[model samples]
Target chain A: MSRALLRSVLELRPAVPRPIASPRILPATQIRALQTQTPRQFNPTAQFVDPQPRPSQLPEQSTSSLSSSSQREPPKQKPNPPRVRLPTTPPEITPQKLDPSVKSLLPLLAAQPAHYITIHIHGRPYLVTEGDAVRLPFLMPDVQPGDVLRLNRASTLGSRDFTLKGSPWVDERLFECRAVVTGTEQEPVRVMIKKKRRCRRKKHVFSQHRYTTLTISEVKVVTEVPEDA
Target chain B: MTIRGLPQISTGRNGVGAFILQCKRLDFHYCDWAGSSRGMNGFIKSLLPKFAAAHPQIEITVSPRPRKHPVVVGHYVNGKTKSIEVKNMEPMQVLQKVKLLRDASGEKDKRTTKPVTSINESVRGIWSPYHGNGMRV
Candidate 1:
C-alpha cells in the first residue's frame, strides 16, 4: 500500500536534531530562531552539526590561513549553550530562628495527619492541598505539561491544631510544595457587536482567552528543625 | 443480613502520576472540487505530514467531504468532539487552529472565579465555642 511505502520512506529519513537543553534558556536570537523554525520550514540560519568529527579538520583549519578562514573554520561542532540543571540539594537561604514557643508547638502541628498551605504565584494566593486543581488566571509561559513547579511563596501553613502565619511571605525552607502543570484550558469565544449611530455597518469582534491548569502533587511539612535554626 | 458498600479510597487525577494529552485524534476533512478548500488542500499536501510526524500520539486522518467547506474535527479522551470550520483561511492560519484544538482540555468553557478547587476536607476542624475551654471576654 501507499501508506506502508510512505512509512518506510519516513523511517529511512534522518531524525531531526533535538536541542541539548530546553530552548527557553537560549539567547534571544537563538530562541527566536527556534520559535520561527517549524518542521519543514525554510530557515537560512538553521544548520545541522555533523555528528562525527573529521580527522583532518584540525590540520585543515591550521593550514588554511586565507583571508576568509575565520568564516569557514569548521561546521562539525556548533557551540552548545550552557545548560542549567535543577539543584540536587536544598539551596542555602536566609535561615529563620524559631522562638521557644514555636519550637514546642511545632511538634503538635506536624503530628496532625493533614495540612494545608496558601501558596502565592504572581502575587495571587491559592489556598490548596494535595490533589487540588488550580487554574491560574494568566497563561504560564515556558512551561510544558507535567512540569513540576515548586510553590515557595506562601502566606500561611496550617494544620488541625496550629497555624504558621508568615509576615507577608513564608520561609521556603520550612516546607515543600509542588504542583504539576496540567494542560491549558480555553474560554469560549466572545463576540462583541459594535455599531455607530450614523453608520449602518455593524462590526463583530471575537476574542478567546486561555489559562494554564495545574494540580498540587505534593505538600510536605518538615518535621525536624535544624540545630542552628 | 447486613450489606456493605464497596470501599473506594482514591480518585484519579490527571498529571499526578503520568500526563496524557487530552486530544486523542484529529480528523481533517476537505473537498476536492471546492474553492474554499484551497488552503485546506495545501495544508494536507505540505504541512499535515510534518505535524502528524511531530505528534505521533495523536491519530490523524484526512478524508474527503465533497462540495462542502473544509473542517477540522478534534476528538478527545473525554468522549467529546469539537469541529471548526476552516473555510477560506490560509494554510498557516489553519495550522494555528489545529494547534489550538490540540492543546484544548475538551471541557465546556466556563468563567472561573476561584483559582483552586479541592475535594479534601479542611485541615483545621471547625471551631465550636462550647467544646473548647471557655474564654473570658
Candidate 2:
C-alpha cells in the first residue's frame, strides 16, 4: 500500500518528462489530460507577433485573452489623409481710385508693346525692361537663386506711345513687375595704400564688394481699370 | 565669289524661356597623407553624399592627390572654371566656398557703375536734330 501511495504522488507532480514511459507511469496520460484542460499562462512569442491590435483600442489585460476572440472582430479601416495646402502671395489692401487722366490713358499704354519701368529699390531708381539684368548696389540678404521677387515700388511705367508718371510714386495696382534672383557677383578687389609724409611705414587695405544679380521676368501693364474710378 | 555670314534676327537670352544653372561640374581633390586635407577627407566621407544628392544637375567627382593641399574646382556652362584652395578649412567653411562658386555667373569680375544692362532698344527713340519735328531754337 505504501508503494502505491508513492506512485500516486509521482503522477501528481507535472515536472516529469513525457518521453519516459513505463507501466508504473500509466497515470502520465491522466496528467496530459489535465494539462490540456488548463489555459496557457504565458506566450513566449507574443512580442514578435505581427498584426497586433493598436494599444489605444485594447487594454493590456484584454490583449492576453484567447487569440480566437481577436479573430472574430472586424478589421479596422485606415483614416483619411489630410488636405494639401498650396503657397500663395498675400493680397494687398484696398487700392485707391485711379486719377481720371490715368484711367483714360492706361488702356492706350497697355495697348502699346515693349514696355519699360523705373523700379525703385532702397530709394534708388533702376530703369529696366523684360529680359534685362540688374546688379543691385548692395547685397540682398536672405535671397536664393531661382526665387522670384515682385517689385512693387515704381516711379514710372511707360510704353512707346504713352508714359504714366506717378506723383512721387505709382500705384502698384496698375502694373506688375517681377524679377528672378540669378546669383551674386563680386567687384574686382581694390588696393589702397595709406602713407604719411616722412613716414617709412605704409599700410595696404584690400576691399571687395558683393552684389546680387536679378533678371527681369515680367513687365506688364493692366489694361482694365475699375469702373468706379 | 564673296563669303557672307548668316544674318541673325534674334538673340538667345538665358532665363527668357528656361533657366539653366551656370555651374555644371565640380571636382574635389584631397590628399590622404597630408594633415591639411584632414577636414577635406572628412567632408568627402560625411557631407559630400548628401550634397551630391541634393544637386543632381551638378556632376561631382572625387579623387585623391598625394602630398598636396586639397582643392575644389568648379566648371561652368560658359566654359570658365574657378578653383578654390580649401587647405586647413573646416567642413562648413568649405561648404560655403562651394556655394559661392555655384552661385557665380562665370564671368570675369569688373567694376560696374550702372545697375541695369539691357540689349533691347529704348522705348523712346534717340534724340536727333536731324529727325522729328524741328524743335524751336
Residue A63 CA error for candidate 1 (Å)?
A: 46
Candidate 2 achieves a global lDDT of 0.68
Best by TM-score: 2
For each candidate, give its TM-score against the true structure: 0.66, 0.71
Each candidate's B-chain TM-score, in sequence, is 0.86, 0.89
Error of 1 at A67 (Å): 44
Q: A29-61, model 1: which lDDT tens digit per residue?
A: 111112311223332222224343222122222
Give the number of the best model, judged by DockQ.
1
Give per-residue CA lDDT, model 1, range B45-100, as digits (tens).
86688778777789999999999999999999999998999998766557767867
C-alpha lDDT values of all predictions: 0.68, 0.68
Clashing residue pairs in candidate 1 are none
Q: Which stretches of candidate 2 lie over 4 Å from their true place?
A: A1-94, A226-229, B130-137
> At residue A71, what lDDT does model 1 achieve?
31
Native RMSD of candidate 2 (Å): 26.0
- What shift in Å separates residue A16 of candidate 1 from its native position after superposition? 13
